[model samples]
Target: MRITWWGHATTTIEANGTRLLTDPVLTSRIAHLRRRRGPAPLPEAGECDAVLISHMHADHLHLTSLPLVAPDAALVVPRGAAKLIHADSGPAFSDRCIEVAPGNQVRIGSLDITTVTANHDGRRLPWSGHSGPAVGYRVEGAPSVWFAGDTDLYDELAAEAGPVDLALVPVGGWGPSLGPGHLDAVRAAEAVRRVRAKIAVPVHFGTFWPIGMDWVKPELFLPPGDKFKAAVDPEVRVELLEPGESIEVLA
Candidate 1:
């Protein structure tokens, strides 16, 4: 399988001649957040077979970004998310939206994808009506891969995902200090150990940040990947990719 990190939680996964995109925040800026590192996402990201939305958070489920995807690419969102997106974006995704909850499965070409639970709040807005089960994906093919959308460490982690060739785990957030329901370098390493993945990739870091705060502590953006590499078990190999960078995970 080939994986490309498109900055922040956006990633492209290609396997078995099919392409799957995850949490696509393709534009350079969303609301007040700006892409501080890496180039804007390329047009090729729009040409995928499916798009996986991990949750309802704006960064992950941007209504504006959804239209950029190929008209044929199915939008796999959390259960009940279609209503919110439909209400908020209106007619943006009337045709190709699939709502999935934890343990639900969907097939696209040769890959079989199963939704797994994530330990994060998936609220579309700060006030109310959160989406169901902020989830991750287990993409099964020749070389299976797990794209952990956004999560903190949870007890059922190991059993939920089983085994996979590659794991994409989030290690940081856009802000300087990560709050509850997030995994920093240390906890993400523990997640690596739990999932038993041969190769792990650190994501959700070194991408976007609030305006004006970029220079306050700039080094905070890029170090989570390296920190995760250092803290994970020595047996597990860590592959860190910058935005727009791709790596092949062998079976």
Candidate 2:
């Protein structure tokens, strides 16, 4: 299996001749923030086979970047997302969208994808009037991969995800202050231990940040991945890849 980190929560997992992209944010930057380090170049959406949206957050389920995926490509989004995607912007929005709830599974090419529950706010904002449940995904192929989306530690996570060869976890966010429904470095490391994946990749950090906050500690933007690696058990190999870098793991 080959995993490529595009940036933030975005990643492309290739296995069995299929490419699955998770939470794509193709823009060079988002809101007032910019990608300061990692991945001089970002991958285009057309390069993927299917797109998985973990939630309705602007960064995760970006409407502007949705067009990058091929029109024929299947779009797996959180349950009730179709109502939100179509009602707000007419039927033109997400024409290929497929709604999925936890435990729901879909077969695309050689991959079998199963949606898993996520513990995060899944609202489309009042202006959009589109709301849905947040979710994670367990993609099974030659080597199974789990994308945890944006979620805090939950007791049922391991059972829900089953056994995955690679686990992609969120360790930080855009800001230093982490609210509920998010995971810090320590918590993420603990999650890695619980899931017991053969390989772990830390994401959701060192991407976007609020403008004019340069005075704040810069390390806050860049240290979560390393911290999680240090805290997690050494037996579980951690691959800290720069954005846009790809790593191949044999099953």
Candidate 3:
């Protein structure tokens, strides 16, 4: 499988003749977070068979960016989150929605995707009703891949060793200090090692930053990926990719 990190949590995975984009934040800026590294994803990045939305946070599920992708691309979102997408992207996009929860499985083209549990809250807004489990995705193809949307390490992280060929784990966030349910560099490394992923790519860091607070702990932005790379087990290969960089993970 070929994976391209499109800054922040957005990524494009091409495998088994199908394309899948995760938490596509295509635009250069969203709200106060601006793209701090690499150029915005090109139009071709929108060419995907499916879009995997890990949760309802604007950073992960930017409603405006939904239309930016191919109209035919199915939006795979957390269960009960389809209404939010419908309200934001309209019925046209909602009609193609495939709502799923942890363990729920769906096939998109040749890819078999299984929704997995995440520790983060998935409410549409901070003030909105916060219920249900946040989610990540385990995509099965020639080489299975794990896309851990935005979560701190879970106790069952290593239940299955080496289950995935490649794991896309979040090492940090756009903010200076991370909150609960978000992994920093060290914790992210442990999570990857626990799963025994043959190859890992650090995401959710070094991409976007706050508009005016570049001076406030700027180390939290780009350094986390390097830290994660340094901390991962030597047995596991770490591919610390910059935004828009692609790597091929062989099965």
Query: TM-scores for all candidates?
Result: 0.96, 0.93, 0.96
Cα error, residue 54 of model 1, in Å, equals: 0.4
Query: Model 1 over residues 1-251: C-alpha lDDT tens digits?
Result: 78898989898999879999999998999898999898789999888999999998889998888888998788899987888877876765845789999899999877899999999987776765755779999998778788899899888899988677788999999977888888999999888888898899899999999988977666668898899999998889888887899998777
**Residue 103 shift from truth in candidate 2, angstroms:** 1.0
Residues 201-230, candidate 3: write the lDDT tens digits: 999998888899988998898889889988
Error of 3 at 119 (Å): 0.7
List the candidate numbers ranked by lDDT, top first: 1, 3, 2
Candidate 3 lDDT at 157 equals 64
Question: Which parts of model 3 have CA positions greater than 4 angstroms off?
Answer: 130-132, 160-162
Instruction: Estimate candidate 3's alpha-carbon lDDT, on a 0 to 1 scale.
Output: 0.87
lDDT of 2: 0.83
lDDT tens digits by residue: candidate 2, 92-121? 655778889898999877899999988888
lDDT, residue 137, candidate 1: 95
Error of 1 at 188 (Å): 0.6
